[model samples]
Target: MSSSIPPSVKPGGHTPHDHDDAEHLKALGYASEFKRDMSAWANFSLGFTYLSPVVGVYTLFAYALATGGPPMIWSFLLVGLGQFTVALVFSEVVAQFPVAGGVYPWARRLWGRRYAWMTGWVYLVALLVTIASVVYGAGPYIASTLGFEANVNTTIMCALGLLALATVINLLGTKVLAVAAMVGFTAEIVGALAVGVWLLITHREHSLGVLFDSFGTGTGGGYLWVFAAAALIGVYQYYGFEACGDVAEEVPDPGRLIPKAMRRTIYIGGAAATFVCLALVLSVSDIPAVISGEDPDPVSTVLNDAFGATGAKVVLGIVLLSFLSCAMSLQAAASRLAYSYGRDGMIIGSALLRRFSPTRRVPPYALILAAVVPAAIVIGSKISTDAITKIISFAALGIYIGFQMVVVAALRARLKGWVPSGKYTLGRWGLPVNVAALIYGIVAIVNMAWPRTPDAPWYDNWIVALSGLVVIGAGLVYMIVHPLHDRSSGPYADAVPENRTKA
Candidate 1:
C-alpha cells in the first residue's frame, strides 16, 4: 500500500500524459467536490506568496546583520541548498499523491492512519502558529507605512485587521485567493529586483568582500554559532512552498502541475530572497549603528538613505503588499489543511469543519477556525510580548518538524522498495536524493532545537524543541482517547462510497 506507486493509483503507474484527476481521486476513495479552478501559474503563485521573500528577508535582515554581520547573508545560499533537497523529496511525494492536507494525507497513504493522524495534528497546529507569526511580523511594517505609532497595541490591532482580511479573502474561495497571490507575486519580484539593484548600484556601503568577514558578538565559538542561528532566516523563508501541494485538490491536473509548481517556488523564492538580503547588507549605511540599536529600523533607514522619506514610504507600501499576500496564502493553506482533516473525519466536529460554503465552494467554517487562532494569538501578544514571541518563534521549527516527518516517511518507503512514479521522477537518483534530504532535515531540526541562549531560562531557551515534543505528545493522547481506527483503517475506509473503485 505504501510506495512511490501506491496500489490506489492506476495499475500501469504514472502516465506521461494528463490522467483523469477525478478518476485518480476516485481510486483513492474521494470525490471531485472541490472546484479545480487553480491554473498552474496560480498554483505556483501560492507557494511563492507563502514563501514571501520580502516579508521574511526584510523582517529578519536586521536580526541576521546584528547576530552574524554581513556574512550572514550567505546563509541563505547554504540553507537554500539544504532546503532544496527537502523540496525535491516533497515534489516527488506530492506528485504521486496529489491530495489535499499535503503532508498529512501523503503520510497516511504512504505510512498509515496513525502516522497520518499525528502528522496532521502536529502540522495543523504548526500552520496555525505560522499564521500568527506572519501576521504579527507584518504589523510593524504596515503600521510604519501607514503613519501609525507602530506600538504593541497598534501592531496587534493591525495584525488582527490583516488576519481578518486574509480570512475573508479565503472565504471568497480559491479564485480570489489565486488572483491575490499573483498580484503579490508580481509585487514581490519587482520589489526585490528594484530595491536590490538600486541599493547595489547607487548606495553600496560595503564591498562584496564584506560578506566573507566574521563579524559576530557572542560568548561562544564566535561567528560559527552566530551563523548557525542566522540560518533560521533561510529555514523560515524557504518553506510554505508546500502550500501548493497542500491545496492540490483545488488545482487542475495536479499530478502534472503541482510538482512543477513546488520546484519553481523554491527557485524563484530563493533567488528573490538572496538578492534582497544581499542588497540590504550592501546598502547598510551604518552597520555598527544598526547593531548597536541606534538605527532601530534598519530596513526603513536603509531605504530612506538610498531614496529619501517619500521613496521609503512607497517601497514600504510594496512591502505591505507582500505581507497581505503572505497572510492570504498562509490562511488559504491552513484552511485547506483543516478541510482535509475534517473531510477524513480526522478532527472534532467533522461535520462542520468539512462543510463547503454553498456559494463560494470553499470551507467557510474551516477558514473561520484558521482565522480565529491567529487572532487570539494577536490578542495575547497585546498582553505579553514575551509569551507571543515564544509561541511565534515555534513557527519555523514546527514547520520543519512537519516537513521532516514526511521526508523520513518517504525514506522509509523508498528503503522498502518504493520507486517514485508520476510525471516527475528521480529514477535511479531517487535513493541518494532522498538520503540527502533526510540528512538535511535531521540536521536542520537539531539546529533549530538547539538552545541558542544558554543564559535564558530553560523554557525560553528550549521552547522550540519542547513545543514540538508537547504538540506531538498531545496528539498521541488525543488519538488514544478518540481512536480513529474505525474511520481510517484499510485502503477504502475514509473514501466516499460513490467514489470507491469497483472491484
Candidate 2:
C-alpha cells in the first residue's frame, strides 16, 4: 500500500475499476505512462496559448480597454518583460529537480517536506482559483458562442459548461490535454493573426503615430517610466505557459521536453501576442471610442472599429472559440497539477489522489475536485464578476510567489555550485538577469494590487478578500497541523509518504 507506488493501486488491492475517464487522451496517441509523452514545446504551447486567449484577449486587455485606454499595448510589453525574468529562473530550477511535480517537488527537494507541502498547497489552490477566474471570464465568450446575450447569468452558465467539458478532457489524461494544447495553440496563433488582419483591412487610414505616442503619462501626470510601469499590467497577459511544466512527468523525455516547451512557449507566444498588441494599437481608428464603450471588449472593439460589422463579428467568433480552448487547457492543467501534488503527499487526499484512471493513466478524483473550483467561481461571478476577477488576479500573485521560491532555490544552488548551470542561462552576468526577474515579479504584484481601474459590472471585493485569505490560510493550516511541520524535519526520499493527509 505505498501511496507512491505506480499511483494505480486502490485501497483494498483487489484491483479496482478501470479509469475509463482517461482513455480519450490515450486514444489520441499520447504517451500512456506518466513522464513518457510530453515535450517542452508542447508544455510551452499549452501555457502560451492558454494565456493569450483567456487572459490577454479576454481578460487583461479588456481591463486596459476599460481602464488604461489604447496605451494598454505598452502594458502588454511591460508584463511580458517582467514574466520573462521569472521564466529564466525557472530554467535554472527545472534542470535540477526536473520532475513532474514542478515547484512543489522542487521546493520539497530543495528545502524540506514542510515548506514543500506549503508550496504545494499554494500552487494547487492558486491554479484552481485561476481556472475559476478563466471560467468566470470565458463564460461570456461561451454565451456569445451560441449568440446568447452574454449577460452575467448566461456567462456563468457557459463558463460552468466549459468547466464540465474540460474536467472530462483532463480526467481522460495528459495526451488529450496535450492534443488540446496543440489545437489551442494553433487557434491562438491564428486567432491573433486574424484579429490583426481584420484590424488592418478595416482601418486602412488608421494612424501609425499612436504606436510610438506615449498616452498614459501625457494625461495621468507621470513620467514615461511611471506610465510604462502602469501600462505593464497588460504584460501579465502572457502567462499560464508554465502549466505544461506541471505535468512534466506525464510527458516523455520531461527534462528536455519541458525546457523546450517552456522556451518555445515564451518566445513564440511573446512574439505573437506582442504582434497582436501592436496590431491592435495601430489598426484602430478611434481609440477613445473603443475604450469608452459600454461593453469595451478590447479584441472586439479593435476589430469592429477597424473593420466593419462583418469583420467585427468574424473576429468575435474567433475570440469566442479561443476562449473555449483556453478554458479547456486551463482546467486540464489545474487538474493535473492538483493530482500531482496530492499523489506526492504534498497536499490533502493523498490516498484518493494517488488513484489514476487505469485505462487512461490520469487522475479522475483530482479532476473532479478541480472542476468544482472553477464552477464555484462561475457561480460567484454570476453575483459579482469583480469578485471572481480580484480573487483570480490575486491568485496570480501566489503563483509568482511560488515561482520566486524556486528562483531563490536556484540562487542558493548556484552559490553552492550546482550542476546543470544553465545551458539555457541568461548569460554574460547571469546575476543581473536573476535580479531583474526577481524585481519584475515583486513590482508586478504591487501593480496588480492597485484598484485604479479594475472596477467592473460585478461590484464587490469578495474575490480578492475571501480568495486570498481562504487559499493561503488553507495552506498554512495544513502546514501547521500536519506531522510534516518544520519541527519534524528529517531526511526523506522519493518513495516515502510520511504524514499523508486523509482527505
Clashing pairs in 1: none
> In candidate 2, what are the lDDT values of residues 1-503, reduced to their tens digit?
55453454456432222232134223322223462444445676677766763346545555454445555566666677777777766765554344555777666655556667667677767777777776666666666657789788887777787778877767666677777777777777887877667656666444666655544434555544445544644545656657666775565444445666776667777777767766766655556655557556556655556667776566666676566666676666666666656555554576676567777777777778888766876687757765666667666667766776666655555455444442345555556667787778666665544444346433342344445567778777766677533443223222112312211
The per-model lDDT (C-alpha) reads: 0.82, 0.61
List candidate 1 stretches off by more than 4 Å: 1-19, 216-220, 489-503
Best-matching candidate per lDDT: 1
Worst 10 residues of 2 by lDDT: 494-503
RMSD of 2: 8.6
How much does candidate 2 score in TM-score?
0.81
Model 2 misplacement above 4 A: 1-35, 53-55, 65-71, 214-220, 223-232, 290-295, 305-313, 383-386, 421-430, 451-470, 483-503
Q: All candidates' TM-scores?
A: 0.92, 0.81
Clashing residue pair totals per candidate (backbone < 3 A): 0, 18
